[model samples]
Structures are given as structure tokens and as C-alpha cells.
Target: MNIDPHKLTPRARNALSRAGLLGQSTRVYELVQSGEICYLSNIGTKTYRELCRYFGVRCDGKYPARRFKPVNAVYLKQCIHYLRGHGYTVIEPSQSHNQ
Candidate 1:
């Protein structure tokens, strides 16, 4: 089954909705299959990360790497590993169809 962006945290969902990416033109599954999502005015790095986590995809190259504290790195790595193990497709921002 495809991941659901709506499953993201409330703050992230609000950001996405305001950005006109979520619940607007493209469905989350279509966005995933296309391998990218357009960047909007309010879709910042934090929001992007939340989207990545929600859709079970990793960020490719367009967005800068998020800097986590040393202690958090382990946790983040674990999360990534978990996502990958579950078979999520990671994509880049440049690949967004709307772009």
C-alpha cells in the first residue's frame, strides 16, 4: 500500500495544505508515484522532513540535509532504516511533476 501524507503530524499537514500541495490538485499516492513534490511558500525544511516521514520516502537532493544533534542521529538513522525496510520509495524535489 502507498503511504499517506495525511498521516503526517497536524502541524505538517497544515503546512502542506497551506502550500497547495496537499488536498489540492494531486493526490498523495500520485505524488509518490511521480517521485517528487513541489515546494510551496510555506513548505520549509522541517515540513519537508515531516512529509518525507509521512510518505515513507527519503529526500533526494533539492533540499538541504537536516542537521540533527549527535544524540538524535542514532534515532534518525533508525527511522530511516525502518522506513527503508518497509519498502518506501525515496525521491528528489526536482522530480516533482508540478515543477
Candidate 2:
């Protein structure tokens, strides 16, 4: 399917870039599929620091990678469902969808 990045807002572009970039990986795969929805696979941000530290991997650290979970209603419901299902204490909105 063809998707338009320009249609997204600046904030959404940032968040989706992270998640969609991860979804582009040959080595990595999506945990949950929601049509064209985005998900970050335990991977940290691809910043220089994150590259040196997590290397797109998931692990415990002070500067851990974050996912894009929108505070908006539709995305909020989805993010909360996953977080709650998995048992998270502090239910914050997502950038990682589940980070």
C-alpha cells in the first residue's frame, strides 16, 4: 500500500518515523500488526548516542529507547490496552507504542 508521509503532522511524523523505520528492518519484525500501524521493536532511537549504546536493541538503561504512543483517543486506547495487558505500572502515552 502507498502511504503519504506529508499527510501527517510534524509531531506524528517524528513518532511514525521512529516506528516505521523500525518496521522497515529486515532483521526486526512487528510485535503486533494493525493494518498500516507502526511499532518499535525493542529498539532504541537511532541517534548517535543510541547507536553506540543500544544499537537499535532493547535493554535496561538510563537513556532507553522510547516508542511513539499518541495521547490521542484512538491511539491512546490501543497503547493502554497493550501496556495494561502486559502489566505496566506508570501508564504514560507512547512514542514507542509500548516503550
Q: Give one digit per residue, the lDDT tens place, for model 2 in 1-99.
A: 233445434443454465444334332223222211222332323332333222233433343333344546677677657755653322344456544
- Cα-based TM-score, every candidate: 0.41, 0.27
Predict model 2's lDDT versus the native. Answer: 0.38
Local accuracy of candidate 1 as per-residue lDDT tens digits, 1-99: 533455678777776565445554346544443333332334556665666667667766455333221135456456546544544332322324323
**Steric clash pairs (candidate 2):** 67-95, 67-96, 68-94, 68-95, 68-96, 69-94, 69-95
Q: Single out the weakest 10-residue window by summed lDDT for candidate 2.
A: 27-36
- Model number with the top lDDT: 1
Candidate 2: residue 45 Cα off by (Å):
9.1
* True-structure lDDT of candidate 1: 0.49
Checking candidate 1 for backbone clashes, the offending pairs are none
Against the true structure, candidate 1 reaches a TM-score of 0.41
Poorest lDDT segment (10 consecutive residues) of candidate 1: 90-99
